[model samples]
Target chain A: DAGVTQSPTHLIKTRGQQVTLRCSPKSGHDTVSWYQQALGQGPQFIFQYYEEEERQRGNFPDRFSGHQFPNYSSELNVNALLLGDSALYLCASSLDRLAAYNEQFFGPGTRLTVL
Target chain B: AQSVTQLDSQVPVFEEAPVELRCNYSSSVSVYLFWYVQYPNQGLQLLLKYLSGSTLVESINGFEAEFNKSQTSFHLRKPSVHISDTAEYFCAVHETSGSRLTFGEGTQLTVNP
Candidate 1:
């Protein structure tokens, strides 16, 4: 089965601009979560989407938002981006809703560069 | 809130040598632990996980992690490494009630042949 897939493998945006990254969940998965991985650091959870609504969010600011479509695809939008917003944005899909036991399948991720 | 800490930022070793990567976590509630490996320009791949049962969990690639509740640590080790094993290793923890994961800073393993 095809695993999670993300669009626009790379993106470049200027400060004060907004960008949207897309992701298609793995086959048979419903929940989608977004993460931000800065250089030399592990990924940090941005937020999770279940049932088309954002269920949980990390310590990220309000500028970071996401949406889960009915087809289980997701889009992460970052508004008014700053230079620090440059990082690798990853999307992961899981079959479970809240259980931590469900393993997540990740996409190759979209590398965002804020210039 | 949960958080993970990987003590080593970089580990270099010769091929076929053993290696250990340390990881520690802090959580107020019960949590599940996981180790993921990321090769260059690739997504994170599940190495192994510790939910319950045995404290030690092994992966097919000869890597294993032992969960220590008292110490709040889950350190990963491999008996023998290969050049292909070089990657960034991440330690993550997730609360049973939440689907989110808290990850460590990651340890870069460089296995030279």
Candidate 2:
């Protein structure tokens, strides 16, 4: 089975610009979540998408938004990026969005560099 | 809200030596704990998880962790380490009523020969 896959393995964006990172969830998975891992830090949950709705969200600002397509793929968009926006963006897939017991599979992650 | 703290930012060990990485969490509700490993330039991978039934969980690579409910800790340990075992280790918690995982700052394990 194919694991979760993310596009634009790496991206470079300037301040005030917006960027979109894509993700295809693992095979047979239904839910997609986004996370941001800054240098020397662990990942922080951005938001989760289930049934094409934002099921749950972390303490991130409004500039960080995401969408889950009908096919279970996802896109994380960051608008008016700042230098601190530079980090590794990860996408994780699970069997169900609200199921606690379901394990999550992660993609290789897209490294975003805000210049 | 839930959060995790990995006590060690970096741990260096010789090959074949034992090592322990400490983790602590804070939550108002019962949580399912997890440890994820991330190699250089890679996404986090599940090491093992503790949901219920067993206070201790083991991975295929000789890594094990014991969940202490009273202490709110899930510390990862390995009896013997190898070079390939070097990676970034993250401790995370998922509240039973929540969908997102709250993660720690991560501990970098460097196993040297």
Candidate 3:
């Protein structure tokens, strides 16, 4: 069984440009969450998707948006990127919310570099 | 709101030595604690998690963590270390109501041979 997978393993963009990172959840999982990890910091939650809708969001701005397809895949879109936006975007997948535990499987992540 | 604090920024231990990485969290309600390992320039991998049941949880890779509710701490420990164990270990917490995880500063565990 494949674990969570992400596309465009690395990307380069300029200021004010937009970028979209894609993620596929683990097999048999239906929940996807996005996180940002800066150069020397731990991952920070951006948002979570469930039932094809955003269930929870972090303290991110409107420029950070996401979509969850019916197939349980998810996309993270960051608009008006700044130099600070250059970081590793991580996606994690887990079983349904009703599960007894919250064990999340993470993808290799997309490294977005804004110049 | 929930937050995690990793006291040590880096920990160095020789091979076959026992090592411990400290973690503490602040939350009002019950929480699910987790430890994730991230190699250089890689994604986070679940080391182990403490959801319920016994307070102590072990990973197949010789790492273990004990969840102390009263202390709001979930510290990772290993009896013997290997060179391959060098990585950044992160501590995170999730509220029972949702899956949002708040991560710590991360501890860089350096195993010296």
Candidate 4:
């Protein structure tokens, strides 16, 4: 089966501008979560979407938001981006949002560059 | 809250040599642990996980890790390494009551000939 997929392999945006990154979860998965991996750092959880609603969120600010469509696809939107926003955005899908035992499959990720 | 710490930022070793990457975590509640590997220009891939049961876990590859609850550590090791084994390794923790995963800064392993 195909694994999780993300769109726009790479993106470049200027400060104060907005950007949206898309993600299609792995087949047979429903929950989607977003993460940010800065240079030389591990990924930090952004938020998770389940049942078309945000189920859990990390310490990120309000400027970072996400949506989960009925088809289990997801979109991560970052508004008023700053230079520090440049990072690799990863999307992961799991069988259930609340099941701790369920493993999360990740996508190749979208590299965002804030210029 | 849960957090993970990968002790080594970079580890260099000769091919066929043994290697060890250290990881430690802190959590107030029961948590599941995981190790992920990322190659150049790639996303994170699950290496192995420690949900419960035996303290030692092995991956399809030669990699294996032992979970020490008292020490709150899960260190990854391989008896022999290859050039293709070079990659970035991350340690993560997921609290049983929470959905988010907290990851470490990552360890870059370079297996050279």
Candidate 5:
């Protein structure tokens, strides 16, 4: 079975532009979480979606938003991107919250470079 | 709010030598701890996690982490290392009531020949 998969392995955008990255969760999983990994730093959680609704969110601003479709795929949208927004965007999938263990499986991630 | 701190930013050690990566977290509520490893050009992979039960958890790859509630720490250790073990290690935590994970700055482990 395929693990989590992300689209557009790499992307480049100038400031004030908007970018959208996509991800497909692992088979049999229903939860998707997005993270931002800056150069030389660990990933910081952006948000998580369950049943097409956002269940949890991090300290990110309103410029960062996401959507989860019924098929369990997710899309992360960043508007008015800033230079600091340039980073690797990772998508992780896991089983539902009711499960005993929620070990997340991650995708290769989409590299977004905002100039 | 939960936060994680990986004490070492970089650690260099000879192959087959033992190593330890320190991690500490702060959370007001009960939380789950995790350790993730990232290789070049790869996403974060779960190395091990601590939810409940025994405080000591081991990974199939010989890596283990012990959760000390009193100390508010989860330290990763391996009896011996290999060159292929070189990678970035991250410590993360999430409240038991939530799903969002807070990560540390990360520790770079270099196992030399």
Candidate 6:
């Protein structure tokens, strides 16, 4: 079975520009979540999507948004990005809403570089 | 709000030696704890997790984490480290009521042969 997949592998954008990152959920999984990992830091939760709607969100601002398609794939869009937004954008998928026993499977993240 | 703290930023141990990486979390509600390992240039992979039943959880790779509720800590330990075990280890906590996870700054483990 395929694990989570994300693209493009890397990107470069200037401040105030927008970018969209994509993710394909793991086989048999329905929930998708996005995270941002800054250099030398752990991954921070961005938001989660289930059944084509956002189910939960972290402390990120409105500039960060996401969508879940019917097939459980997801897209994370960052608008008006700041230089600080340069980081590794990670995508994770789980069987369902992350219950007690469910573990998330992550993809090779898309590295975003903001100039 | 939930938060995690990993006491060590980097840890180096001789191969075959036992190792322990410290983690502590604070949450107002009951939470699920997890340990994830990320190899260089790779995605984070779940090593083990503590959900409800067992205070001690073991990963397939012989790593284990013991959850100490009284101390609000979940420290990952391995009886004998290998050079292949060198990677970044992250501690995360997800509240039972929510799906969002709060993570600690990772600990980079380097096993020297």
User: Mind giving the per-residue lDDT tens digits that candidate 4 earns over B18-105?
Assistant: 9999999999999999999999999999999999999999999999999999999999999999999999999999988788889999
Please give the DockQ score of every candidate, comma-separated.
0.84, 0.87, 0.75, 0.87, 0.72, 0.76
lDDT per residue (tens digit) for residues A7-114 in model 2: 999999999999999999999999999999999999999999988999888889999999989999999999999999999999999997445667888999999999
- Deviation of model 4 at A31, angstroms: 0.2
User: lDDT of all the models against the reference?
Assistant: 0.94, 0.94, 0.93, 0.95, 0.94, 0.94
lDDT for model 3: 0.93
Question: Largest DockQ belongs to which candidate?
Answer: 2
lDDT of 6 by residue, A1-115 (tens): 8889999999999999999999999999999999999999999999999899999998999999999999999999999999999999999999874455457899999999999
Q: Identify the leading candidate in terms of lDDT.
A: 4
- Cα lDDT tens digits, model 6, B14-74, are 9999999999999999999999999988889989999878899999999999999999999
- From the highest DockQ down, the ranking of the candidates is 2, 4, 1, 6, 3, 5
DockQ of 6: 0.76
lDDT of 5 by residue, A3-55 (tens): 99999999999999999999999999999999999999889999999999999
Q: How would you encode candidate 3's per-residue C-alpha lDDT over A1-115 as one tens digit per residue?
A: 9989999999999999999999999999999999999888989999999999999999999999999999999999999999999999999999885765567899999999999
Tens digits of per-residue lDDT, candidate 3, B1-113, equal 98999999999999999999999999887889999999987889989998889999999999999999878899999999999999999999988877789999899999998
Better of 1 and 4 by lDDT: 4
What's the TM-score of each model vs. the native?
A: 0.98, 0.98, 0.97, 0.98, 0.97, 0.97
User: First chain of model 2: TM-score?
Assistant: 0.96
Error of 6 at B31 (Å): 0.6
The docking quality of candidate 5, as DockQ, is 0.72
Candidate 2 clashes between residue pairs 3 or more apart in a chain or in different chains: none
Local error of candidate 4 at residue B45 (angstroms): 0.7
User: What is candidate 1's lDDT per residue for B3-111, written digit by digit as tens?
Assistant: 8999999999999999999999999999999999999999999999999999999999899999999999999999999999999999999898778888999999999
CA deviation > 4 Å runs, candidate 5 = none
Model 3 Cα shift for residue A23 (angstroms): 0.6
The stretch of ten residues in a row with the least summed lDDT in candidate 1 chain A is A96-105
